[model samples]
Target: MNDNSSRPLRLGTRRSKLAMAQSGQVAQAVQQLTGRPVELVEITTYGDVSRESLAQIGGTGVFVSALRDALLAGEIDFAVHSLKDLPTKQPEDLALAAIPPREDPRDVLVARDGLTFETLPEGSRIGTGSPRRMAQLNAWARELGKEIETVPIRGNIDTRIGFVTKGELDAVVLAAAGLSRIGRSAEVSQFLEPDAVLPAPGQGALAIECAMTNAPLAATLAELDDPYTRVAVTAERSLLAALEAGCSAPVGALADLSPSPDEQIVTEMRLRGVVGTTDGKTLVQLSITGPVPSSSEEAVAMGHELAAAMLDKGAAGLMGERAL
Candidate 1:
């Protein structure tokens, strides 16, 4: 330990309920790991206050910049972010210190009357803001010989669920991890399989970031890193970066661990990806499993290779120029 245990660490977080709840868990983990007191510093983000839709404002970066600024300005020692909201490119002065163990990385349907996807009435309206979700839902509807309408909506989970409770929509899709974090997992009526609807890259994970210059704090935060989660997210995000896609692009990826015979912490990354148009037409999906990555660099290479395979199949043209 760098012996910073005597001083309380400041953890920056968005003021939203989900953000606070997630930050609280990280704070407790820090306390238990280092015997240090942690203070929560609420930081408002552009995404929190802006009325512009996430897609119109260019995806989740609006939720991330303010926190990074706080860390760089020394307003807080570190900031916790929903990994899916972070940009693939990182600021040179910031170091991603840790990726804790992930929660369920599947998207779940929160519906009225506890209805599953199959049982939802034809032309039922479902609310979601993610292009990936919209595309996948449309594709799934086509697969089942059904028609459902996707409404563009954005808000905190409670507000989203209200649309269903108030009969504004028949259902909503949300990350199972978010509901689980806020103690509302029981609201989920069904878990969307990755084959039918993959999750966003890095969804259901947290990214702990600190100033690169703060070696002691960064080292301390690294203590909480889960190697399995780190490798999985690395491969997923590597595809996003390699494909030159933004956070809101109609792209979904997930990487999970497979059993290994050696007991040396070796794990294989079985990664799946999807790319499609928002209307559900021109959908392309693929899967590839890579051998145990000896280093983060190797893990990222596997992602690039997998992306190359997808691109070779015209996935890039299907994505069009909207990857911006």
Candidate 2:
């Protein structure tokens, strides 16, 4: 071990409640793994301070760059990030050290009067900052012959849910994993399955990143990496990269594993991708199932192949600046 092994590992994270909660969890794990104390270094990010909606201010990346800057400056040893917030392109100087096991990737509905999405009355107002959710919700509403208005919203989970409680909105769409991490999943009235609404690529997963030059620390963090989750999200993010879409784009993707009959082994992997207009009038969704990827190369290829198929079906037209 290097002399620094005895030093407390500083984990850079945003100061948001959700960010702190998740970072605390990772810090505990690192302390256990390295037999050293870990410290939380709270950093304010542009996304956290900006009242502007995500799409207007530049999507999820805004929440990440500040921490990345801290890492590159050697002010923090590593960082924890919601995987969905990471840009498709990785910085050359950093390493994605690990991807912990995922949480539930479904989107959840929290409605007033304990209403599920389907039970909500027509013309009910739903608040969400996600274009992907708006597109799918509109499409789903049309299918049910119901009309609901999607209002653009921005805030942390508490503020978002407050909208419903205050009668400002009928409901809100949020990531089930986020609520679960914050111990608020019980408030969810409905879990929107991938069948109706695919989640953003890499949703429900956490990424631990460190300076690539720090091989010893990177190797230590790699111990927490779950192979299945890594491959699954690799395929998902690769698809996003292939589509040339940013995190704010109206694009959703998920890569799921099919377990064997014994439920002890994964036998196949299924990749799904969707691109749609925010209005929900047009959508292009596609899926592909194949043997579980044995290597990272295979996973990347699978995503590229699936992305190609979606593009052939006119997925690009649905994306505004998301096109190649």
Candidate 3:
């Protein structure tokens, strides 16, 4: 324990409802563990202020850099972020002290009428800002021999859903976990299966970051880290790193860990990754299964290997294209 009870734990978070909800959860956990009060410090990020498309905003770091700045400057003792928003490359001075257990890492389609993808009308307007979701949805539409339009939309979950409710869009794609965490799961019309729509790397997970020198704070955060979740997200993040892709790139990956009944204590993990064109015209996906890695480094290596296999099959060119 740091024995700094006089100073409350300062938690930095974005102002979005989802971000607040997630950060609040982490704050509650820390308070429970340390029996100390925690204060949440809201930080507005570029992603929150920019009306320009994500690609124009310099991709992955938009949502995270501000928080990192706060952490480095001691404006806050630590910060929490959606792991998916974090860049694959971490800053050297900051440490990812904890990755709490992951949530459902699947994309969900929210429609006004509870309509599934197949049941949607022809030429339906689907809203999403994620190139990865757009790519998958378009690809699936193509396979089904249906014409669909993907509209560029951005906002927090509620605002995005408003498009559908207001009849501007027939449906929208969002991460299932985000909706679930904010008690908006009822808005989800269909949970897109992983095979149909792989999630962005590190989706549905939270990252707790603190200064590298804050060993005491880091040690406390370690108590919140779930080993299985850490291993799985580590592998997925590693794959993203190997592809040299930013968070906004059309990249999706997921790793699942399951306890082996035969081995009693051993667990097996299956990792899946994809790189695709923003327009859904091309894609390369790969999957691998192995025993859960004992260390974060090993898990990351597995992800890299899977990404390399996909790249060898022409994933690079697809991932390199400009967002549509």
TM-score of each candidate?
A: 0.95, 0.98, 0.96
Best by the lDDT measure: 2
**Residue range 19-42, candidate 3, lDDT tens digits:** 999999999999998787899999
Residue 117 lDDT in model 2? 83
Backbone clash pairs in model 1 (N, Cα, C under 3 Å; residues 3+ apart or in different chains), count: 0
What digit string (tens of lDDT, one per residue) describes model 1 on residues 1-324?
Answer: 134557788899999899999999999998887787999999999999988777788774889999998988888989999999999877899999999999999999999999999999999999998989999999889989999999999899999999999999999999999999999999999999887889999999999999999998889899999888888888999898877778888899999788767756556768888888988977878889877676788879978988898888877765532544
Cα-based RMSD of the predictions, in order? Answer: 2.1, 1.4, 2.1
- Count of steric clashes across candidates, in order: 0, 0, 0
TM-score winner between 2 and 3, please give it: 2
The per-residue C-alpha lDDT of model 2 at residue 111 equals 98
Q: After superposition, how far is residue 219 of candidate 1 from its true place, in Å?
A: 0.9
TM-score result, candidate 1: 0.95
Residue 89, model 2: lDDT of: 83
Sorted on TM-score, highest at the top, how do the candidates line up?
Answer: 2, 3, 1
